[model samples]
Target: MKKLLMFVCLSGFAGFPSTAVAAPVVVGLADGLAGNRFPWSTTGGMRWQQVFSAAELTGFVGQNLDQIAYQTVQGATGYTISSLVISVSTSNNAPGSLSSIFANNIGSDNTVVFNQANVTVGANSSSGGFDFALPFTTPFLYTGGDLLIDVLAGGSSSAATFFRANGSAVTTERVYSSQGSPGDAGGTATSNGTLVTQLNFTAAGAPELHPGGAVLPLTFAALSCLIFSRRRRISY
Candidate 1:
């Protein structure tokens, strides 16, 4: 009987059959994000349509979303992605796919290469809408700087309807007509119109901070406490 008691007590000190503890730490999250559509200040019929661009990003300060809010808690950048409303004012113009929306990494050649996941578009001038949270094939990080969202016309026109980029030194450049070559393919509109948007990035989360990770150190601490208690009892 005494030997069995010793074994039981030894097991407890060995940190086996651990006790489950309640977790009470609640962390806040970032605001949900949605793309905003703004009308160009100028609207008129010209030989080549003039691309309207969003104003230079005046603020890195973020706006609020009703459905979901984006926040930074415990160093992790929280994202609340959802559907967004959009609109295009041109006669036959419309909002296209977001597949092209990606992280443009500056290359060694001093150019940009956008890397991201495939995307789809279904919104129109009448009732603009978009679905966010499509799985990202190439999720890029925005350390800081300009980010452009270009709307391209499918082989339909040599000119682009619009093009927009957001970040510091925000400037809206609209080209009503194509300067020359057909320009790159895809949804990026050469002259459709572009809007300048603004954004700021928070630090990304580290692997160690994930949940279920606090156990290791906590277990060690608990084991130490138990050993101390056993030693005191033995001394007595």
Candidate 2:
């Protein structure tokens, strides 16, 4: 009877689920610095409209992407960020055009969309810039080697907001500018040799188990059955 009870206790303890703790992951062109250049959208007047930036993640595939944070500079007139689109592709080359990124399935297979209802920024004169967190409705799983982050701002207005660019510069990634309207995808060129934007994101590290879920209940049930059987045997 004592051995049976010990066995039951050991089984119950072993079946307990472990706590799942995910680690944070950040990917960007460079660390933000003071007095960084603010790159604005191209569609709005003199300022550029859409800036397409790409980066290669060092982590393995299948990591859960949680939130994306980018540095921005507010202009005289407050601007609203319309949406943020993230696409993953195997190819390292830049997409032919912004519109083509969505339509083409050649390299990009996974696309996550985040629509901004009122992601606005107030005017700020500070050169340190402001970091904005744009959380995804659902976490996206990393599938490809390269990530293309497309930020759309100035929804239906000429008012401008600027995204801070990498001052230290990066060679692996390039920034593309579109002179025409959003989704136009025409007359695109590399704006700077190594002037990529500063951005970061959080991703899940290792997976963990939990208690009181499916496994725990089954373990308790088996343990109860074993205890009951042992009790009956001892009584007889």
Highest lDDT: give the candidate number.
Answer: 2
Provide TM-scores for the models.
0.26, 0.53
RMSD of each: 15.5, 7.6
lDDT of 2 at 40: 38
Model 2, 131-159: lDDT tens digits are 55556665656664555554443342434
| Worst lDDT 10-window in candidate 2 | 44-53
Judge candidate 2 against the unseen true structure and give its global Cα lDDT, from 0 to 1: 0.46
Off by over 4 Å in 2: 1-26, 30-56, 74-78, 82-106, 122-130, 152-158, 172-180, 191-236
Tens digits of lDDT, candidate 1, 1-236: 44565666566556533332211111110121222221111121111111222222223213111111111111112221121221112111212212221212112222212222222222222322111112222222322223232222222111122212222111322222232222323223232233222222222332213466667866776677568667767877
Q: TM-score of the candidate numbered 2?
A: 0.53
